[model samples]
Target: MKKRKTLLLPLARQFTVILILFTLCTVCITIYSTFGYSRLQTSFLNNSLESYSAQLAKSTREAYESYENICYSIAYSQVVQNYLMSENRGKSYENYRQLENQLSNTALLNPYIIDIAVYGQDSTFASLCGSASNYEEFSRSLSDSRFPYRSAGVATVNRTLCHVLAMPIYSLGTGESRYLGILFLAIDVNNLLGNSLKSDENDYDPRILFTDASGQLIYGEPQLYDALCREEDRSDVFQIQETSDNPVTYAVTGYSIPGIEHTLYVLIDKSQITRQVARISGRQLLVMCAITFLALLFLFLLYRPLIRSLKQLTDFMNTISSGDRRAMKEGAVIHQGLIGSKEISEISTAFNDMLIETEKLNHTIFDTYTRMYELENNNRKTEIAFLRSQINPHFLYNTLTMICGLAAEGMDDKIISVTGALSRIFRYSIKGSDMVTLEEEMSIVRSYLMIQKERFEDRFTVRYEFSEDSHDCLIPKMVIQPLVENAIVHGLEKSLEPGELLIGAGRNPEHGYLAIWIFDTGVGMPESRLTELRESIHRSVYNKTGDASADLEDLNSQNHESIGILNVNSRMVLYYGTDYTLLIDSEEGVGTNIQIRVPYRLKSDTNARAAQNTNSKGENHVPGNCD
Candidate 1:
């Protein structure tokens, strides 16, 4: 139950945060749509109408100026001038006909011009434009009676409003000129204004109106213009008006033509644009709500399974702490509790891998420490066995028993000498230290040899050569005694003649090693036996240390003279790291010579008894290459 609460707490917090942010975004969008969309709709309509009105004003003004240019061109022509200057109005009919033809040609080429005509009150040009009453009255008031062609904004002509251009003719040649009649071009104003705007038969389309300087409505419905803009707003370029019939507001845009005093009005009903924006806002709000619903649904559905996976992981961790290693290995480290997060899955996988590796490492460390402890124990036992081998229990019993018999026989000197040697041997072997001065080790060697001589009944002769400088050096305790024991058990006891045993220690001048040699003139070892012994020593040093207990068991099994030599070799290798070993020379009928060389270790014993400077030489022990 606690695990469920722990997992759901984070998910609940996450969902709460997301819901708040999503709601805030929806609110902001709703507020923006409510007020901002309506403002944007009004702004767009105003800008569009303003552009359209500017276009209409520019195009309508150009049409008026074009008609004025046509009238001016005809009035300056040679045909009209000649007709005005001619005296007889009837006989000079060709000039009048020529002038009439020019006016007709101009009217035919211009579609907007209703007619182009010339009137000469004094001359014979035809008055084809019904009448020109205003042109006649204006001509009589002129000093030269010549009117320049110009735009007269808007006036009724032939019962229809038309734009008029009046051009007066003169008797124009190179000489002095007199005024002729006026050439008046009447343009249909209604036609131009009607064509300037797009047809607004559809009520939704924009309605436009053009008004002259005197406030005469030229185009579009007057009702729409008045409803959209007030008299004051019409003077402004852009304005808005609210209507009474409907709550729809209208946009009004007006532009003035450059040369003429006429303004173009463009009106648009803003409610149509409002309805479009409202529909779009409604759809957007619906979609947002739907998306919010789906998001909530997805998060709610996620609760159960994600919490289940988290609970599983929590249980797995608890089991791990309780030491259930098998369960940890079999459980999935990553699953759907990831809840769309790749990083959490990666962390789970890494932790699982770490635990697996840690377990392996723990086992490896245990095995390593176990082997080290066994090796240390085996080294202890080997040293113990070596000390005891030098003073065997049975040998001590027999030696004491022999001394008693000899004392009964009244051999005081032999009993005392043997007992002293036995005492020194035991004292040397019982000391706890493994290191001893070389001279002390030699003393133990002499003691052991004396005991052997008394037991052998004068069957072997002994020889010794010693160097005083090398004798003070330190060596492992009882290292040399094992080699001497092997020589006696295998050499002197087996020879038919009185055998010789040579024991010597010296500095090897060539190798600078402290060389100790043991030679015996007993029956020499066969080459195969010598090889076998050498192989045994070498194999023990290399192969046996991995399992010291196995070596001990093997030693217990073997009954041979090689064990002591093998033991010495193992101890040497263990101490000196494989630098010291035995070198043996032998002949089958002669004797065996064994030499041991060790790195010259200095005497650590500062105040020890001096070695006996004596040699009982039966055979010379050579100090150089004995091979």
Candidate 2:
């Protein structure tokens, strides 16, 4: 019962952790979606306001240009010029009637024209189309200005607000022209902007305004105009927050009409955007909640059977741990009927087999103990033999010959350096622990490469690449050197052209291992040899009882061509396990790559036996790579 409770505690903790992670992910996705959607909606609204403001400004400029053209035509008319040039009283009334008729006909050109009038320099005046009551006042305000055309500002004419324009007429008769009079054209402001100001179906309730360069309002609400003028350094698009006086927040955008010194402003209420975002956020939250609930339900269903199977297995283990022989015999048979997944069923079968083995061990405890002692002693002998195989006599003879050649050529420094590097290799190989820091191992590899460099001359080059952080990681001694040696002897030495050899070590934190690799660009092996080499390296030594001795003898009998690599593989398996062995890959005429993976351990982890056992059985094995 205690074991069952112990097992259940971890499962409960795991379920809680999974639930929390799922909820956190759901919340994060919800927040991101809501924020992104709000930003998208705001961007869309700003673009719409900008487009709307541009359209209104364009229409206003076109209308003003049309009205100015009419004023220009009337100012240069022959009949009007003739009337302004005439001084006869008898023809004055006749000229006046013709001028009035002409003005009436010109007013028909635009439906929004309220009135057209002419004020003469002699204080004479004539009107048509409407009561032109303000024409004299409008023309008198700009009497001193020399400009041919100008706006006379907004005024109440015929009890309606009108946009008035004033143009100075000149006598068309001659050389040094004389100022004849002023022509005033009054246009209905409401009718001019009516079509442009209508709200769209989206119900944004956009307010449109027209103002001069100096911020003088020509059209739109006076309150909004006053608020807009208070803002400093306004850009093409901006927002207005709700205040005490202005209770509505607005998104404001505008455009300046070129050559007219006028700007058009479009203001949209922000409440619409806020409501849209709220609706979308609410829907997202609902979906997130639904998904979270369904995910939690699935987690519960998936883990329920696993939890039950574990509880049953724990009970059986507890019965065995109690050391009651009769209870153990009964529990073993009962657990064979235990059920769950295929993996769980296999585990139950293995547990039963272990129990049956335990019963057999009770009958032959003496024999089992004797064999275990023999295996340990033989394992040590095998390791010693593997170490001896790493020191090649031919390699030493070659290095001595190269030193003699350098000495005869009077290169004393080259001979001394080569001798020193060769001595370091022998000293490091002879006196060291079976496990050493990656830095120490790499030092030996560099020493070995230096000697090889002297031996091969310019036939090959060596490159060392190692991560600084992984320099302190612990690995089996002499494991990487043999791989490097194999890369040179079997791979690079066979090539006619100069070759390159790369040796590197780094931490593979994702897989919790240390990765050491040797790559050579040289004549590579065929597919058949590559496959054969991989099978030989991966082959287990102790597949059954008393097989360790046979495997060691077989390794001794293998050819010298693969003896170095096989020795390295054998040591790694004895120390770490098959799971953390060597990986070899080769392609014909391309290259060969060899990699070694071992559990990442530091000097602080001094218990090598515990580490070996844990790596061999406790952890799942990950496949190797040559990259």
Tell me the tens digit of each residue's lDDT in model 2 across 1-627. 454534445775787887898789888988888788778867876677567667777788888888788888998998788778788987988888899899999989988888888888886788774444577676667768487566777877767788777889988754988888888888887778766746655546677787766677888888777767767776444445446665666667777765446777777767776776677778977887888899888877767677777778887788778766776675443332333467777787788888788877875996888888788767766655555445767677888888889999999998889889888887877776778899998898888888888789899988888987788888888888888888898889999989999888888889999898899998999999988787666553444234556666676565567777787877777778668777888998888988888889888666777788788965665567211
Q: All predictions: root-mean-square deviation over Cα?
A: 18.9, 28.3
> Can you write out model 1's per-residue Cα lDDT over 305-412, one digit (the tens) per residue?
555556666777898889777876765464664454454566568778888888789889989989988877677666545534544444667688889888889999
Off by over 4 Å in 1: 1-375, 390-409, 453-469, 496-500, 505-515, 542-550, 573-585, 597-627
C-alpha RMSD in Å of predicted model 2 compared with the true structure: 28.3
Provide the TM-score for each candidate, comma-separated: 0.40, 0.41
Question: Model 2: which ten-residue window has the lowest total lDDT?
Answer: 331-340
Q: How much is 468 displaced in model 2, in angstroms? A: 76
Please identify model 2 stretches exceeding 4 Å from their true place. Answer: 1-23, 79-111, 122-129, 190-194, 197-209, 213-215, 228-260, 263-627
Error of 1 at 582 (Å): 4.2
